[model samples]
Target: MGTTGGLADDRALLGRTSTAERVADILRTRIAEGYFPPGTRLSEENIGGALGVSRNTLREAFRLLTHERLLVHELNRGVFVRVLTVDDVVDLYRTRRLVECAVVHGLGGPPFALDGLAGAVAEGERHARDGDWKGVSTANIHFHSELVALAGSERTDELMRGVLAELRLAFHVVDDPRALHEPYLARNREILDALRAGERTKSEQLLADYLDDSRTQLVEAYARRVADDGETPH
Candidate 1:
C-alpha cells in the first residue's frame, strides 16, 4: 500500500481520545487540504497505524466518508478517494446556489458580522501574493464555508461541509489552480464589501453570479480535462 503523505503527522491530532466520527473529520479535512487527492488508494494499515486507531475504527471512518461520496470502496481492491465527474460538478453548484444564496438572502439588517468573510478574503489574497494558488483555493472554500455560517444553523454548516468537501474532489482535477481560483479572489472581496455596506440584496446577487460563473468555469474545464484524458464522465 502506498503511503498517504502527511497523515502520519496528523496522528497527534486525535491524541488519546479517538472515535470514528473524529477520525472521519480528520480524514475529511485532509482530503479538502489536498493531502489525499482524488482516486488515491487509501491504505488501511498505514492510515490506521498513523492515527493509532484500531482497524475497525478506521474502517468505520472510511464507511462514513464513503457515504458522503468522498471515498469509494472496491471489492477486493480496497478504498480510494472519489474522482468527481462533470455531472457531479454541476449538481454541486446547483446545491450551492440554493443554499448559499438563501443564506445571504435570509440575513438580518446591516452591521452584520463580516469578520469571518473579511478574514477569508484576506487569507486568499495572501495566498495569491505568495503564489500559492492551492492555498488560495483552500481559502476560497473557507470563504464559502463562512458564507454558509452566516445562516447560524449548525445543520446547514454540517451540510455545506460535506458538500464543499465533495466539491473539492472536483477542484482537484483542475490543471491550473490560478486560473480556477484567482479570478474569484477579487469577486469574493466584492461580495464582502457589499455585505459590509449593508447591501444584502446586492451581496446575494453577487453571490448568485459568483456561483454561476464558477460552475461554468469548472464544468467546462473539467469536461475538457476528462476529454483530453480519454475518459467519459460517469
Candidate 2:
C-alpha cells in the first residue's frame, strides 16, 4: 500500500485544527501503529494531499518527528521512518527505567488515578484473547503511558509519547509479537494490582523488574534481527 492509502478519514482530525504539530501527531500515531514501519519512505505529496495540509506544514511536521528521532531526513533523499539500532534499543530501555521507575516511586499513596492503567490491562487481555499480539503490544505501551500519567505531569507525558513511539520502532523488528508482548501483559496487571492495593513500594519493584526483563528480551531480539539484516549495531 502507498503511504497515504486510506488516509482520507484522517483529514477530519485536522479540519478544525490544522497545525503542524497536529499533523505530526497523526503521523506519529500512524508510525507507532505500524502503518509506516521502519525504513518506509514518506511521500510528502501523497501525505499532504491525504491530510489536506500544505507541503510547508507537512515538512514542519516531518521536522518535528525527526527531532523526536522517529523520522530521519536524508540528504538528497526523502524522510523515512527510522530503523532503530541495537544501541538505540538499549538506551531506550535505560531511559524507560529511569523515567518509569521514578514515576512509580514518586506516587504518594493509593487512589492514584488508576482507571487508565486498568483499562490498558483489560485492553491487552481483550486483544490477547482474540489472538492479536500486536494489539497486546500496543496496549502494553498504553499501560506504561498511563502509569506515567500517575505523575500528573504534562511534560513527562509528552516526553514518553515520543520515547514509546520510538520504542515501537524497535518492536517492529521482532518477528514474534506473541513472545515479545504476552509475558508482559500479566506483569502489567501485577503492577496495577499492587498500586490499587496501595503497595507503592511493591509496585515500583515489580515495575523495575518488569522493565529489566523487557529490556533484556527486546535487546536480544533486536540485536539478532539487526545482525541477520547485515546492519552494523550502533
Candidate 3:
C-alpha cells in the first residue's frame, strides 16, 4: 500500500506539470491565433473549467505567460492579453535599432557568428516554403536573436528576448503572419550577406531600413485591426 501510494503521488506531480504545460500551450496558441483578442479578460475559473484543470494550475500557467509579456495581470480586475500600442511599437523599434544596429556594426573584425545567423535564415526559408507561418515566425525571431547573441552580452540577449516576446504579441493581433514576415525574409539574407562580407557599416544601414519598414507595416496593420474590431487603442 505504501509503495502504491508513493507511485500515485509521483504520477500526480507529473500530471500537474503536464497540466501547466498544456494550459500554457493552449493559451499561447489562442493568443497567437487571435482567438482571444488583445485586452480580452482571462478568467481563471472559466479558463480552468474550459480546459478541465483546477484554478491553481491555471494560475501557474498564467504566471509564466505574464512573465513572457503575453499576458498582463491587473489588480482586482484579472489578467488580459496585452495590447501593443503605437507608442509601444515606436519604442520597441527604437530599442531594436539602437541594439541591433550596433551589434551588426561592431562585428567589423572577424570572429563573428555568421554561421548561426546563416542557419537561422536557412531554417526560416524552409519554414516559409512549407507554408508553416508559425514556424517561419519562430525561425525569423531566431535569426534576429542570433544576430544579437553574436554581441556576446547576456543582458542584451535578455532584453531582446523581452522585446521579441512583445513583438510576437503584436504579430498575433495582426493575424497574417505571412504578410508580416515574407518581406523580411530576403532582408534577413541581405543582412547576413553583409555580415559575412565584413561590411559592418553597410549591414547596419540595411538593418536600420529593414527595421523602419517593419515598424511601419506592423503599426499600420495593428491600427486596421483595432479599427475593424472597434476597440479603443491602448
Candidate 4:
C-alpha cells in the first residue's frame, strides 16, 4: 500500500479510535485489500512519517497486526506481511467451514438479515461483468464477510475479518487471478439461490462443497509456488 495518505483514509474507515488503533486499522485494511501483499516489508520511517505518528505509537500498531497473524517480525529485516503456509490455508478453510456453514445451517429456524449476502452477490456480478477480476476478488471478500454477518454476532464478524485477511494472503499468490476467481461467481450464485429458495440443507451442503473445492484449489496453487521455490509446501 502507498505509505502516504493511509491514515486519513483509514480514519474515515475506522471513525473514532485511539491513535494506535487507527494506525492498526489502516494497516489491516491495506493488508486485506492486497495493498500490502504477502512478504512486502513495512517501512517504519515511511509509514510512521506518512501517518504523522511517533515511532512508538506506530510500533504499537504494528504489534497489533503482528498479533493478528497479519504481520510478521524478523530480527533485522523489519516487519513484513505474513506469508501463509499450506497448513495455514487448511486451518483457514476449517475456520470458514465452521463459521460460514454454521450460518447457512442455522438459516431455517430463525429470521435474519439477508441484505449483506445479496448485496455482495450483486457487487460480484457487477464487477465480473466489466471483466474486473481483481474487483471481483475484492467483492468475493465482502461476500464471505456478508456470509459471516449472517451469524448475527459482532464477535463472530470480528473474528472472521481476521480470518479473511489471512485468506487474502493465500489469494495474493495466485498465478492467474481470473482462473482463481472467475469459476466461483456462478457457484456463489447457486449458494445464494439455495438460501433464497429456503433450501437450508441444500445451502449448507453447497457451502460445504464450495469450501472443500476452494481449499483444494488454493492448496494446489500455493503448493506449486512453494515447489517452484524449491521449498516443500506445508
Candidate 5:
C-alpha cells in the first residue's frame, strides 16, 4: 500500500510539473500570437478552469511569465498581458543598441557558435515567406539574442532576453510585420558578413543603425495603433 501511494504521489508531482509548463507555454503563445492582446486581463480561476489545471499551478506559471515581462501583475486587478508604449520601445532599443553594439565590437574573433544565429535568420525568412508574422518576429529576436551572446556575457544575454520579450509584446500591437521586419533582413545579413570578415567596427555601426530604425518603426506603429483604438498604451 505504501509503495503504491508513493508511486501515485510521484506521478501527481510529475503531472503538476507538466501542467505548469503547459500553462506557461499556452500563455506565452497567446501573448506572442496576440490572441490575448496587450492589456487584456487573465483571470486565474477562468484560465485554470478552462485549461483544467488548479489555480495554484496557474499562479506559478503566471509568476514565471511575469518575471519574463510577458505578463504584468496588478495589485487588485490581476494579471494582464503587457502593453508597450512608444517610450518603452525607445527605452528598450536604447539599451539594446548600447549593449549589442558593444558586444559586437568587443568580440575578439568569431564566437563559439554562429550556427544558431544563422539558423534564426533563416527561420525568420522562412516564416516571413509563410506569412507567419509572429514566428518571424520570434526568430528575429533570437537572431539578435544569439548575436549578443557572442560577447560571452551571461548577464547581458539575460537582460537582452527581458528586453526582447517586451519588444515582442510591442510587435503584437503592430499589424504589418513585413513593413517592420523585412527591411532588416539585409541589415542583419550585412552585420553577419562584417562579423565574418572580422570588421567589428563596421558590424557594430550597422547594428546600431538597425536598432535605431527598428525603434523608429515600432514607435510609429504604436502611435498608429493607439490612434486607431483611441486608448493610450503604456
Candidate 6:
C-alpha cells in the first residue's frame, strides 16, 4: 500500500488549529448566538452527537469554555452555562470601564474608526423601533466591540469579546428587555457624536456615564432575579 496523505491539508479542511479548539469555537458561537441560555445544562452526549465530535474532544472544549467562565462544572452534576451574578456583573463592568474609557483617551488622532460606533448606534435604534430588544442588545455588543477595535489591538478586542459574552448572560435576567435596552441607544449615539466632534473629554465622560448606567441596570436586574430564585422552592 502506498499513500501520501496530506495531513496539513486535512487540518485546513477542518477549519481549525485543533479539533478541541474548533469545538470550543463552535460552542462559543452557540453561546454568542443565544442558542444556549444561562444555567442550561450542557449534556455531553447530546452536544457530542449534535457536533459530531467524540466525548474526549467535547470535554476538552468544555474545559476551555469553563476556563473562559462561559461554563461551569458542578461537583457531581455535569457542566452548565454560567449565570453571571450581580457581583460578576459589577466586576465585568468595572473592567469594561477601565478598558473602554482608556481606549477613548488613547485615540491616536482624527479619522478615528468611529463609523462603526455610529453604525452600531443606528442598528440599535432601528431594532428598537421595530420592537426587537434582542436585536438592540446585539447591536449594543457590536457598538462596544467597535469601540475596543478603535485601539487596533487584537488582544484587547479578544478580551472584550469574552467580557461581552459574560455580560450577555446578565441581560437574560432582565424582566423587560425593551425597557432595559431602549434608553441606551441614544446614549450610544451621543458618545459617537462626541467622538466625531473630537471632544475627548466629553466622550470620556459620556462613556463613564454609559458604563455606570449599564452597571446599575444589570446589578438591579440580577438582584431581582436572585430574590425571585430564592422564593422559588428548589
Cα RMSD to native, each candidate? 8.4, 8.3, 5.9, 7.9, 4.9, 4.6
lDDT of 3 by residue, 52-159 (tens): 999888988998888877888889888999988777878888999999988887764864668889999999999989999888888888999999999999999989
Instruction: List candidate 4 segments past 4 Å from native.
Output: 1-17, 110-112, 229-234
Query: In candidate 6, how many clashes are counted?
Result: 0
Report the C-alpha lDDT of model 1 over 26-80, residue by residue, as the tens digit: 9999998889988789999999999998888899899999999999998998998
* The 10-residue segment with the lowest total lDDT in model 4: 8-17
Better of 1 and 5 by TM-score: 1
TM-score of each: 0.89, 0.89, 0.77, 0.88, 0.82, 0.89
Q: Write the per-residue lDDT of candidate 2 for residues 139-196, one digit (tens) a residue.
A: 9999999999989999999989878999999998778899989999889999988999
In candidate 1, what residue range of length 10 has the lowest lDDT sum?
9-18
CA lDDT for candidate 5: 0.82
Clashes of each: 0, 0, 0, 1, 0, 0
lDDT values for all models: 0.91, 0.90, 0.85, 0.85, 0.82, 0.86
Q: Quick one: best lDDT, which candidate?
A: 1
- State how far residue 123 of model 3 sits from its true place (Å): 1.3
Residue clash pairs of candidate 1: none
Number of the candidate with higher TM-score, 4 or 6: 6
Worst 10 residues of 6 by lDDT: 8-17
User: In model 4, what are the clashing residue pairs, if there are any?
Assistant: 1-35
Cα lDDT tens digits, model 5, 85-113, are 67788898998988898887778875436
Model 4, range 1-234, lDDT digits (tens) per residue? 676756766754343237889899999888877888888889999999999988888888999899999998889779989888889999999999999998777764534467888888889889989998888998998999998888778998999988998899888877677888888889988988877777788888998999899999989998788668664221
Model 1, 52: alpha-carbon shift in Å? 2.3
